[model samples]
Target: MDARQRLIETTRELLHERGYVGTSPRAVQERAGVGQGSMYHHFAGKADLARTALERTAALERERAEALLGDASVPPADRVVAYLRRERDALRGCPVGRHTQDPDVLADDGLRSPVEQTFAWLRQRIAGLLAQAQQEGSLRAEADPAAVAAAVAAVVQGGYVLARAAASPEPAAAAADGAVAMLEALRTPPRAPHRA
Candidate 1:
């Protein structure tokens, strides 16, 4: 890859692994195999490079989510389950979700914008799927789509945290499975006929 591309990709990985404070410009340059002059030639500084990388990460995240959740051919309820069960590296944690814990990234709008928008989009998409499930009678009419969606998001994010804290992927898997089970419970079962 080119210097600019290498810098961006390296920054994204570092940001995901080390958070803002942990990822130094020197580290980025060394990892990217680029000299200070090369990095400076491509971008203004760390903030500029980080902004570009974060935006790229968010876009990729949205595209992957939309592929599963936005698929019209799949049943809305199935789509929700598919997304929750999607394979991911739990120990590694979420690239975007991890940003919320970074004080530096949280303090800067330029750095935080992509992270904020990515989560907002994810929650909104889940809410839409739940709403569709309700409309189709797949989900219980009494369940609020927005609240359920928030819970679902929480389960996934919290799963990452659990996994990282335990230093094992099992907790994350269990969390996901539990979330799926809750969603299964939300399904409206056929009612038995009343005995007159």
Candidate 2:
């Protein structure tokens, strides 16, 4: 890869492994194996590079989500289950959502925009699917799509935290299973056939 791309990729990894405070320009330069000149030439500074990296991470995450949630052929509840059960590095935490814990990233509007926007888009997208299912009489009409979407999002993030805290992947897996069960419960039961 070119110097610019290398810097961005390196920064992305550093940011994921270490928050904004830990990902210094020197660390990025050393990790990228590029000189300070190359970094400065490509980005204004650490924040600039971190912002680019965060944006890239957010985009990739959105793409993966879209792939799972975008299929109309799949039942909406199933789509949600697929998303909750999608392969993830549970112990490593979310690439984009992890940034919300970083003070530096949260303090800077430029750094936080991508993270905020990504989550907002995710909740809205999931809510849309739930709404569609409700309209189709597949999901209970009493269920609130927006509220459920937010809870679903929280469960995933919280699952990561639980796994990380417990130092095992089981917590995350259990959380996904629980989420799937809850979603299944939301589906309307098939009506009994009538006898003459």
Candidate 3:
């Protein structure tokens, strides 16, 4: 890759492996195999490089989510299940969600905006899918789409934490299974046929 691309990719990896506080400009330059001049030429400084990398990471995550959640051929509930069960490196934690714990990233509005906006969009998108399912009589009428969406989002992030803490992927898998089971319970029962 080019110098600019290498710098961004290296910063992205560093940010994921180490939070903003730990990813020094020198480390980025060394890892990227680019000179100090190359990095400064492309980005004003470390924060600038981090922000750019973070924005790219956020966009990639959103795109991946959209692929599963936006498939019209699949049932809405199934779409949600697909998202929950999507392959993840539970032990490694989420690329974007991990940033929520970073003080430096949270403190800077510029750094935080992409992370905040990505999650908001995820919840909103999931809620829309749930609402659609409710309208189609697939989901229970009494179920609240927005509330369920938030819970779904929570479960995924929580699952990651649980997995990381336990040093096992089973917790994340179990959490996803539990979420799918809950969704199954919320599905509307089919009507009995009328006697002739």
Candidate 4:
């Protein structure tokens, strides 16, 4: 990889493993195997490098979510279930969700923008899927797509938090299973015609 790409990729990994506060320029340089001059040449400083890395992470997340949720061949409700149950590094926590806990990152818009945007996009995407499912009669008529979408997003993040705190992946797996069960409950058959 080129010097700049190396710096960004390394910074992305470091930022995921260590929040903004914990990741340092020296650490990024060491991980990237790039000299101070090369690092500075590509990025003005740590903040610049972090912003680039965070943007890459956000873009990747958006791409994956779009590919899964936007697939035309899969039923909308099935897409939601698939996304919720997809394999994740639960004990390590969400790479994007972890950023919200860092005061340093929250203090700077450059760093926080991607984290905020990613969740916002996810919630909207999930809501869209739910609405489509409802229109298709997969989801019950009374189920509120927006509210359910928020809860679904919460389940994933909460699962990560619980797993990280407990130092086990089981909690995360259970949370995801529970979410799927709840979503399944939302499904209902179309009503039968009334007899005259």
Most lDDT-accurate candidate = 3
- List candidate 3 stretches off by more than 4 Å: 193-196
Query: What would the TM-scores of all predictions be?
Result: 0.92, 0.95, 0.96, 0.93
lDDT of 1: 0.91
Over 107-187, each residue of candidate 2 has an lDDT whose tens digit, in order, gives 999999999999999999999999999988899999999999998999999999999999998999999899888888899
For candidate 3, report its TM-score: 0.96
Q: If the candidates were sorted by their lDDT against the true structure, best first, what order would they fall in? A: 3, 2, 1, 4
Against the true structure, candidate 2 reaches a TM-score of 0.95
Q: lDDT by residue for model 3 over 6-53, one digit each (tens)?
A: 999999999999999999999999999999998999999998999999
Estimate the lDDT of model 4.
0.90
- Clash count in backbone of candidate 1: 0
TM-score of 4: 0.93
* lDDT accuracy of residue 162 in candidate 2: 97
Higher-TM-score candidate of 3 and 4? 3
lDDT (CA) for every model shown? Answer: 0.91, 0.93, 0.95, 0.90
**Candidate 3: Cα lDDT at 47:** 89
Which clashing pairs does model 2 show?
none
Of models 2 and 4, which has the larger TM-score? 2
Residue-by-residue lDDT tens digits, candidate 4, 1-196: 9999999999999988878878889898898899999999888899999999999988997887787888889999899898898889998778788888889889999999999999998998999999999898889989998899999899999999999999999999999999999999999866799999
Question: What is the lDDT, from 0 to 100, of the residue 159 in candidate 1?
Answer: 94
